[model samples]
Target: MDDDLRERVEREAEKHALLNAVKHESDADVGAVMGPLMGDNPEFREHADAVPGLIGGVIGRVNDLEYDEKRARLEELAPEELAEIEAEDEADEHDLPDLPRADDHDEIRMRCAPNPNGPWHVGHARMPAVIGTYKQRYDGWFCVRFDDTDPETKRPDLEAYDAILEDLDYLGFEPDATFKASDRLDIYYDHARKLIDMGGAYTCSCSGEEFSELKNSGEACPHRDKDAETVLSEFEDMIGGVYDSGEMVLRIKTDIEHKNPALRDWVAFRMIDTPHPREEAEEYRCWPMLDFQSAIDDHIIGITHIIRGIDLQDSAKRQGFLYDYFGWEYPEVVHWGHVQIDAYDVKMSTSTLSELIEDGELDGWDDPRAPTLKSLRRRGIRGEAIVDAMIGLGTSTSDVDLAMSTIYANNRELIDEETDRRFLVRDGNEVPLGGSPPDEANPQLHPNHEDRGVRKIPVGDAVLLESDDLPQREERVWLKGLGCFQYTRDTLQYTGEDIEVVREGDVDVVHWAPARESVPVRMRTMEGDVTGRAEPGVAELATDEMVQFVRVGFARIDHVPSGVADDSSDDELVVYYAHP
Candidate 1:
């Protein structure tokens, strides 16, 4: 026997002998009588020598068995008992977040203002997860603030906004309240006036390139010498659209020659001609720039913690200047490194991905390949799995690009059990003489997963198998958890290309079917045309039911119109969403 097998056999034998010896111990004294004969006997002596090590090994094996038997015993248990066990097990495995130790000094209460210029991407996803996590653990509020200050780059209307909310919602995330920068124009304007009255801000009518050059050369602009009153008048004129677009901007009166040019008189507000989505055109013209608007809003909204990406690390400095300028309280900021995926070897960008979605180069934001929340769902990613993934990474500032497959596989492990199992026949062909599916075919559900007790699958004389398996058939094949089979094929029909049909030689074949009429559907994959088949009617499965087709992997129901549920016509049908 191989070393591993031999070790296992010897281990088992030792375990059996120890138990027998222990039971018979009551029959005699060990040192005076039992030890002498047992020590002399070859088998007894061997077992005695190995018993302790084998006992240790047996305990380890028992632990392994219990771990894999998560949902197994439910197959034969009462529903109530099964539920109790499953719930208890879930509670036992529930992971608690590692909350920061509350030092009296560690305070956070803030809004997460994301520019809705594009759909939420990977880095954007992580920020909210971390923010929501901190908000929950620290008793701080996190609001989804639409940073709509810059209309030049913002997408008009609610398309991107709606999608962002949908993605966050799907991931079990929510904010305490929703706010938009556009709603706080008056607030920002008031702050601008405060800075002007304090002689800390001035309006400059420099061209873009002039300001760019000034910023680069660290040279003071001649326009910087104007008094606060004259600067205030120009600021009012700019807001009143007295100045043409991009003609002049209200800039903080910081040292123009400061070593860090970004700290040197950054523009606090600028002119914009476009209409704000949340405000009427007549309501505003000059917009508060990012740092200026964020600092004021953060103080006003009582935001104490600001979690953001490391790319914006300098933002902390600019924001600090704004807070200092206005003498406003600043929030504690946490910046984590951005996430990149190796498959693409670049950062994920919402704007780039949105263009792909708009140009028809990609499906909707939820396309399986897109990496958006919807895409992850379609790919059978589990919420718990995502939580696990994020938790394992922890909060760090080091840059990293983990493999997409690693996260997918991590979530897949959690998803496989929660979902039911089905069989999928890619390029379908039927098997003959399927030992008649029992009149009432009910396979023991998961032997241990009582919550998912016995499942009843339709069995018939002839069952379908995947086309790929037809030509590769040999003498025997196993039908998953079912029995084994032998098979042979007749001259199966084949299309000119590659599709084929085959006879069931002698094998128990298993595959999914509508058991009646299947709902015609298309599935997406990297190579495309993964499997297109009609699914079972919606009435048979629970709305939230997740299932893996035996050979084809996992799938969920898409929200759509079907005869089984809504009365809408086929053409009017919307896919009712489901996931594995």
Candidate 2:
């Protein structure tokens, strides 16, 4: 490469490094810097191999400088990029890119199509978040379309349709309109007839193996040459239940000699004996394939744009034939790569999760282990956190891997200041007091918010301390908000009530609950169940209220032993741990 081009690449790479380091207050990553480094500088595109080394060299220099130095260098190098960072910091974290050919259209129309075979998983939430953003950006109408056509394989659960709408509302992405593919069977059949009449589609009675052989050999099936009238007649019979399941099929016409076999003639519709879950489709046995049905609906509903995974790029190629035959303008399409959440080890397959639930291994869809939106919500994960985490991913065509820590951090920011603190002693031991202390100790419910109130914990003869937090031999410990204690020989002796002395001596502060008013706390965490003892006030909080366990972590009150208010009967306080 020429010296001028090489110099340009280095300058661009340095700009990203400085901007990244200044914004994050940390060392810039080679992978993180590479995207903008090459994106803004097309001159360096041909030298892809050299870009990483250039970025690496730049990151080292950027990392070595102080935070202020990095900011100053970035402003000096590219003042606009520094200003952009400041603006981004003050605004929302997720700023999606503009739509392609957005200005050419007068109005924007979008859809988030999901198969209602099961409740929405975390991965399924992305489409609505992203597409809804565009809908809002353009003041356009958005539709939540259910692609619940495959009854025999992915049978749509009747409950999932409503459940998905509830999730959208929870995520603040409620659609302006909603519909299902099963309700539009006649629409698909109408398109199929026109397609056959236009000589763009045909019905094949050959077995699956025979068709595969013909397709692999770059040849059409024997029925491919049938006239339009004859083909339509056969298609009608196929839909009229003349053929049993898998006995006949309708195939869309593509390039017979196409190099990619998948782009070659593909199945447009197939017969299935298993009725659709929805009553409207119960009488129908023939179902239109996903691509054909979705493509037709996109045109019929005037979808201006389509967002899909790059893996299904072939759908566009295959569906283009039908569009051309019908002389319909195809909607602008954008393909995004897969998003692999590193936190979830299981594949985001509904069938796999359903089987596990049926086997009694999973405690239904909302189990903390299941990677569904319901699970995250029940575990005290806010809807905003899920939306932010997904929108922050943007619509990159390259596969993106992410850790769930980002979501947890975002959720913490939203709930940390609001949730009141409570003391929970896991696996407790009764420790007697050595001195005559006050009858009770009151700790601030929230350290920062004194106006909220305090937990009036009665100090009896002894206090319940977590077995793990018990003062070691000769070690001094401060029972938070109560008093200091020193463990000597086999006794825990109270030292003094002064907080300054404990801080001066650098004593360990451990959480404790009054032994007299203790309640059995059953905590459900992602790792496993934790049986703990909490102050009586913990059981008084309303269910679903978020609270933080002192020295432990944040958790939501799932259920308090029923009738705790009516009598002295003690019941377990069940809570779900959020995160540390």
| Top lDDT hit | 2
Query: What range of 10 consecutive residues in model 1 has the weakest lDDT sum?
Result: 494-503
lDDT by candidate, in order shown = 0.58, 0.82
Give each model a TM-score. 0.73, 0.84
> Against the correct fold, how does model 2 do in TM-score?
0.84
* Residue-by-residue lDDT tens digits, candidate 2, 294-379: 99999988899999999999999888988888989999998998887767655677888888899997898888778888888888
Model 2: how far is 425 from its true place, Å?
1.6
lDDT of 1 by residue, 360-476 (tens): 877777765565666666655665556556655556788866665565556555554465554444555656534332333343343224567665544445445565555454445
Candidate 2 yields a Cα-based lDDT of 0.82
RMSD in angstroms, all models?
A: 12.5, 11.4
Which 10-residue window of candidate 2 scores lowest in summed lDDT?
42-51
Candidate 2 ranges beyond 4 A from true positions: 1-94, 563-570
- Best-fitting candidate, measured by TM-score? 2
